[model samples]
Target: MVQDALAGAGYPQHVLVACSGGPDSLALAAVAAYFARRGHVDGRPVTVGAVIVDHQLQPGSAAVAAATARTLKDLGLAPVQVRTVEVAAAGMGPEAAAREARHTALEAAADEAGAAVILLGHTLDDQAEQVLLGLARGSGTRSLAGMRPSRGRLLRPFLGLRREDTLEICRVEGLDPWHDPSNTDPAYARSRTRVEVLPLLEEKLGPGVAESLARTAAILQLDADYLEEVANATFERLREPAGGGHARNDRTGIEQAGKGISLPEAALRDLAPAVRFRVIAKAAAAVGGQQPSYQRLLAAEALLRRHGSAGPVELPGSVSVYRLSLAQLEAEGQSAAAGVPREGARCGKLVFRPQRPSRK
Candidate 1:
């Protein structure tokens, strides 16, 4: 299934499997190698490598990483690239932060190795947990989509496979994987959700509840994608640059990329309700540096449409929305969106400062 999925997606010949010596990751590495070998036997071959990231949060992490590398080499796999990265914060306070750091390391490694896709070991069980967590957040649409199969260079090939299946694979291959004690520690919310909540729900609700939740998330992702497309079209028409951001003299160019979702208040109000809502939401998202919810967007729309100079309306990411005038919706800064600014002359509110200012 893993090999078929990769081929179906037109996955690149060079593959990088993210391994951590855990059962899930170990199983993924083994499965990936199996598929690659089969391809080689069938006249088509793939170059496969494994990368193990040691967060160094534990004393034995380095040793575990080394063991993982040794295991891969013994299995006729290429030498595992072991990366020891600092977790920065101590203890279990920043689980999300640690995961982000680990992903960053994986991306950097993939880029360095020229690997087109980084395979993750996230099983169906993980997907279910993500759905449960997303539900807890009480957000709508996009929030419920959970994890994606293809996110940039990272791909979760094992997401369709069950945890039990992965464990069985490890057993068949005589792979002894270490269990992370942290996974069972009640100190973590996810651990409690897994050990306490999920089991109880499974008993009371029904068997295969986790699978149901994952399926739901998959459906939600499709809906989210469509909504984003509609939102993008609506956003393109009314966007303008925020304060201290580069301006776009080429409205046609900016519109094509959906950056102008930060349009002025006057420009936004001229649109119909559906279009207005999307424009407002996009503007807030651009200003807030976070994905603006429909509710937040509605509030922003009300504020701007009412022509209220009440005060700066706070959005995500230290961004504020202001009605500089009846026709103007001013964002605090140009960082409503992530990444570097586009190249061009300054226009509207978005400013472009060249690395070296032209002195003629």
Candidate 2:
């Protein structure tokens, strides 16, 4: 399955397996090495290597990293590298921080080795856990979609495989897998999900809960992808050009009317709610604005559809959206010229403005 996934993703001549000496990664390393030694991943010869990122969060982590690197060498993986990463405690908590740091190190290692893709060790269980967490958070469809099998330079070939399969592979290969202590630490939500929540769910809901959740993720991923494509196309159509060209003032280059996106009120009102909300969200993001909550998006949608003389609705980052008519735009221009800026404009059409520079 791993070889098939690699091949399907356009098997590169050089592949890097992210190994943590765990059953999943070890299994991946073993299989990747086997295929590489046989002169092909999906039928083409390739060079396979292993990269173990030591996020030194636990005691004896360095020793564990060394052991993992040695194991990778024994598995016939060449160019085994152990990269040390400093995990900083940031807003997302220690577990998230460690994950971020680990990924950064792996990318660097893959670049150093000239590997085209970095293989991850996430299994179906991990995908299930991720879905449950997203559900708990009440995040949108994208979160429920869980991890993709292939994302940019990262590939998770085991996403369709069970954790038990990796363990069995390790056993058959006579490989000793190091169990990370963090995997059992209840302090992490993922650990709790894996150790307690998933097991309890399996016991109560029958044996296939994890598999069912993974399937849910796979289905939602398809929906999310299609919606995103529709949203991108809609955004392009609705976005008004600036100075007869695309909006390029901001780093993101999303065309802006003023400090926000201006779309024809009719055009936006005609869209389905799913597509409408996504367009609103994309507009916010294009202007380098934070994601608006559902309520906020609804408020924006209402102004467009209901035809109200309402709002200088406040959004995150001190950004504001207002429905402006040609008359209102003329009035605001007069007010600005008269040295008294309008406080807020009535809602009739959408208008975006660039953020004003702070006075020094």
Candidate 3:
């Protein structure tokens, strides 16, 4: 079933496997290797390279990463590279910060190996946990939908399978899985969810509860996909390009500064609530300059729904959107109720003013 999905998705070809020495990832790496040897998804043969990221948070992390690389080498998989990623303990919580760093490191390794697809080991269990977590945070449909099977260059072949199944496979394959103590520690919310919450939920609700949640996520994914399609179509009618100058449209830049975006008030009023939210999201992303967090998106949508308001709303540090009667742009935080300048006329042709000169 897993191999068929990879074949259907054109994955496990020139693949970079994220192996953390845990049972889930180790099983994934081994299974991918098995399929690669058979040339199931490739004309020439598939090449599997293992990438282990050392977060360097713990004292034994570097040695563990080295050992993981050696283990993969013993299994006939060459080491593409081992990377050490640093995460600052601020702004983002520890779990979120570590995840971001790990993904960044994995992407870098995949790029270095010239790999088109990167395999992760997210299982059905993880999907259930994510759905529960999203509910806890009161997030939107996207979060409730859980992790995608294939996002960008990343692919998770085991998402439909269970973690216990992977562990069983590892035992049968004679692979010694490395257990992370963090999984059992109560210090992390995920650990608590895995050890305490999931078990209680299972006891109260009976088995297959996790599976039921996984099924919910799958259904939500289909719905999300359809909604995104609608959003793309609506975006075509609603989008108003930013005036020239400001920042270049380079998605690769960090702290994207000096970009301009605008929206048509008439156009916004025509769409339904759902379509309106989607249009705002795209415009904020495209020209307002950065990807707003889920929370910020909701806040922006709220402000828009109320008063057909004009002016700025403060978001997380250093990010704001100016909803002028005529235009909107991503800028630093300011008072949302601030009076508009008389000269800030509703000129059909709004010009972009750069906050600062480009590095050049």
Best-matching candidate per lDDT: 2
Candidates' lDDT values, in order? Answer: 0.68, 0.79, 0.70
Off by over 4 Å in 1: 39-43, 90-93, 241-281, 285-288, 292-299, 324-360
True-structure Cα RMSD, model 1: 8.6
Model 3 agreement with the true structure over 195-291: per-residue lDDT tens digits? 9999899999999989998999999999888888998887775455454533432332322245555555445555677777776777655643355
TM-score of each: 0.79, 0.86, 0.80
Please give, for residues 120-181, the per-residue lDDT of candidate 1 as tens digits.
99988888888887777776767678788878777887888888999999999999997888
Candidate with better lDDT, 1 vs 3:
3
Candidate 2 structure quality by residue, lDDT tens digits, 1-360: 777777877878888999999999999999888976787754677988989998888899899999999888887888999999888866668878888999899889999999999999999999999999999888899999999999998999899899999999999999999999889999988999999999999999899999999999999999999999999998887776222222223433333344355666666766888998898777767766688877887776766744444455555654556566646556444121122124322323565444443322
lDDT of 1: 0.68
Ordering by lDDT: 2, 3, 1
Report the number of the highest-TM-score candidate. Answer: 2
Backbone-clash count (model 1): 16
Candidate 2 TM-score to native: 0.86
